[model samples]
Target chain A: MKNALQTVLALLGEDYDSILQAWLETQKAEGVRRPDLFSDRESRRQLGDILRGLGEGISRSDLSEGIALDADSWTDLRATLDEVTQERVERGVSPSEMATFILAMKQPVFARLRERLAADPTRLIEEITQFSRVVDALAMHTNEHFIEARDQVIERQRAEMMELSTPVVQLWDRVLTIPLIGTLDSMRAQEVMENLLNAIVEHSAEVVIVDITGVRVVDTQVAQHLLRTAAAVRLMGAEAIISGISPKIAQTMVELGVDVGEVTTRPTIRAALAHAFRRVGFSIEKVENARG
Target chain B: MADTASVYLVEHVLLVAIPDNITDTEIMSLQEELSTRIVSDGARGVVIDIAALEIVDTFVGRVLAQLSSMARLLAAETFVVGMRPAVAMTLVELGMDLHGSRTALTLSHALRALRSEGLA
Candidate 1:
């Protein structure tokens, strides 16, 4: 009797078209194959590539191991799955949807194997077990790749958001401002300090206003982060003004007995700017309309 | 080898630029040189620029702190200027205090700050 792996490979070679047709039918029936996001022609081409790739490597792939996708013989198959995974992830396809392409093949392959090995009940069961193992491992590999691709995108977006949130804008010739949003964690506070110091050096800024208007929480850790940034700014010879303290955050700070040290804190950005202007030897006056 | 990179006198302010690869012996001699110059030239202010220095270890930090206090005894104020962000973070991490030493963004800013304090 041919071994289960060989039997499955034989069925893959002889009944390729039938198996492909059955797999696509089950996918369509189960709503796994999204026609709206992927064209029917492209879907067939992708499925054909994966099926051919499997046939090419399934012989060398050890059915006993849980993961055959990592085998050297299955490099081409892995590449095909990776391409499919990337495309689907970009298309906003869910993990289940990405895995279904590999999973739906189980029904077609199992059905064909059962038909061929019907006279030998024990061999038919063995082939079914071996085939399920291969398909399950492939499904997991596809899901892992999909999640990794999505994670990469998430990591990139997070970095961009961080850099975007900590902008140090020059408010005056010798004054700079950084309007901070979100929580002032250690990492973010460090970034803010770096940016503030760089701006002070770049603009020879004598004073910096850190507006925390968008930040809601004022725990001790955040207060410490703010103080550290202020100290760093001072170390660069520029003063730091912690601005935009709401009544609630003020109450929290007072209750927590958070000492902001010698660094200045203002109630609002306008007030901070005024204080900064005074420190930098500048003044702002509202001009009356000439029409008067 | 050359003590420090350069030293310039602007009015009562002494502008000293420190190189990245300064040796420990050179730093000690440089501090001595600065102390004598403060007394002999009647220099009322000192600006130590470390923009060229990439690393500021605890030893360097302690010496800077001491240098400022030493200058103060001689009736001269010290300001460390042009400290890179990395060095500042490292100093803050090490919890090094400059005592009465002030910091400035540049040599020019340090001079201005000292002048405001009536150095000139």
Candidate 2:
């Protein structure tokens, strides 16, 4: 019981350079090393950072805490893993590929430990178990962080998409338009209503044309969201005019008994704008003598 | 948050100031009490001041709309005023329409609208 973790630390500390070299070679042998994706200097730097953090972590950790390393004592190790995983996830590297980088380190370190502990089989088993557990923990930790980072990336992208889909345009001095371009899910519907209402208040808009031309279909839920948006506008003392109702959508609306409720509907944005202009008391007229 | 309906009769108008948190039972009783007050007192208009309310869910929204409709049936106009922007947004997302109810930005505006509509 010579403290397997401390022994591994000594082994790693004494020949850190060679262990990194062996680790890099093992990565290349496993066909996971992509020099094109990561330069030799970058890979070497990451390995150096990992080895340094591992050494520092092992020194601070209490091995009697069993195979599980104390999470608080491994802050640097966690940081390194987070950084590596975040970059890899952003770069479109697969989880397995990211895990491979950490797991590949095991071969070199194990080979070194086996050679050094060849004289004693019981100590060898203990040391191998201790070393493999550390590697597995690090690999598993990296995978977990990678998944979290990927989910964060996805969530951010979804928010960005919601904002992009619900663009509020100022069509006139006191008239704004929101042209929804996708399926109106509850989340997107909320986003649409908030953006449209804020715009209405900001402009003191008298008329708002909600153009759903780009929207795919009008289900009961979608109709409800539209009605809600219009109702909010009316509540704000502004008239909400829905435009771009296709014949099919209109039929669907009638069938579903969906009521737009005192809000005017137009077949197109142009017609809605005309109606908006009329509602705001700005009638368009054709001037004479441009036909020469 | 007050359980009893805090209704004030101001110049032939039922002035109802809704609190921040009201239960369904309270809302129902409020509706009953206001309708009775409107009829018995000969109130010509109602101005619902929802400024104290931060959030209005579907039930509250439906209740507000229904209250206005009830007032209309009694020949009294209803003006719902002081709706916070956030509350309005929540109401819209919940698909609550204050049907045939006039909305004003402020209590003064509500009174003015009722006056202009010839209800007061």
Candidate 3:
């Protein structure tokens, strides 16, 4: 096993360029190349770097003990693939497409080993299995990194969207308004409370109108989050008026037994604003005008 | 433990700023001191400013609620002021209601709310 692996490593070190060229040909023939999504030059460079790094990692690796690539010994290989995965994820490349690209190198490397080790069938089988395992391990590592990078991208966008969605506005001298949209989770609830409280202090707001017309459902968890926000607002000495409770939501709230004690609820933002104005000692009267 | 919370009179209202590093014993003594000051000085309102505090465990929460109820017995309104949003959320999550005690965003707002309602 050791001698067969040494022979394969020797071949890779000696004829690295030819195997890499064969792999590129296989990749192109397999239609893994997508020029429409990005420039082919950049993708080719990433693949080339990853192959070179993988070759170096395998040559120095001790495959006699096990086929798994030790993370510390394969730092360069991991770094190269990490860059490729990050770029591919940013370009919206599907995981299957990435898998296909990484898997295409297997056939070319296998063919090279066959040509060199076909004299000994048993050794050929052992070396081929070891080489295949190494390739498989690298592919799996790249795939895992691809998914992690994609998740990080999504997590970042979610955070940015949360900040964009929760905007605290001041409707009057002592009134603050937060028009909620989409689902309300615990983290978002915390964000809402923080933003509202900061706005209250910033504006010295006495009344806060939390409009939930954009919210589609009010489940028990969502109700609890809303109630917590209201309680936090009250702790700040500002009245929290939950507005725009559709009939559907009101029914859901009752079914859920979500009691919003002392937190005023209104049917619409307009009504809530009026109530807030009244609470802050303001009243709006209709104006009568004559044409001049 | 090093320094206790001090209750002072500001505009005929008791101003109790609970320091962040106060010990449990200090908290009790501070509550007693507030009671004594509220009665002897004839304070119309009591504002407990806790904005600098990061956590209000169940014990501290109960003390604040007790202080409010106790102030009512002395004919003085209790307004907990400057509660951080995070602290308020945690208190709710911990199932502590502060028992219907009045809360304000700042010292000034606490004073204004009490004055507007004729409690201060």
Q: Which regions of candidate 3 fall more than 4 Å away from where they truly are?
A: A1-22, A58-68, A71-75, A106-137, A148-175, A185-204, A219-221, A254-259, A277-292, B1-7, B21-42, B114-120
Q: Per-residue alpha-carbon lDDT of model 2 for A34-101, expressed as tens digits?
A: 78778899889888989998988877776665645447878898898789778778878888888898
For candidate 1, lDDT tens digit of each residue in A54-134? 888777656565545677989999999999888888888888887887799999888888889889889888778877887
Candidate 1 chain A: minimum summed lDDT over ten consecutive residues — where?
A: A60-69
* Alpha-carbon shift of residue A27 in model 1 (angstroms): 1.9
What alpha-carbon RMSD in Å does predicted model 2 have with respect to the real structure? 6.1
Clashing pairs in 1: none
Name the top TM-score candidate.
Answer: 1
Is 1 or 2 the stronger prediction by DockQ? 1
Candidate closest to the true structure, highest lDDT: 1
Q: Report the interface RMSD that candidate 1 achieves against the true structure, in angstroms.
A: 1.3
Of the pair 1 and 3, which is ahead by DockQ? 1
Pairs clashing in candidate 3? A236-B104, A236-B105, A237-B104
Alpha carbon lDDT of each predicted model: 0.85, 0.84, 0.82
Per-residue error for A61 in candidate 3, Å, reads 5.0
How many steric clashes between backbone atoms does each model show? 0, 0, 3
DockQ in order = 0.63, 0.34, 0.57
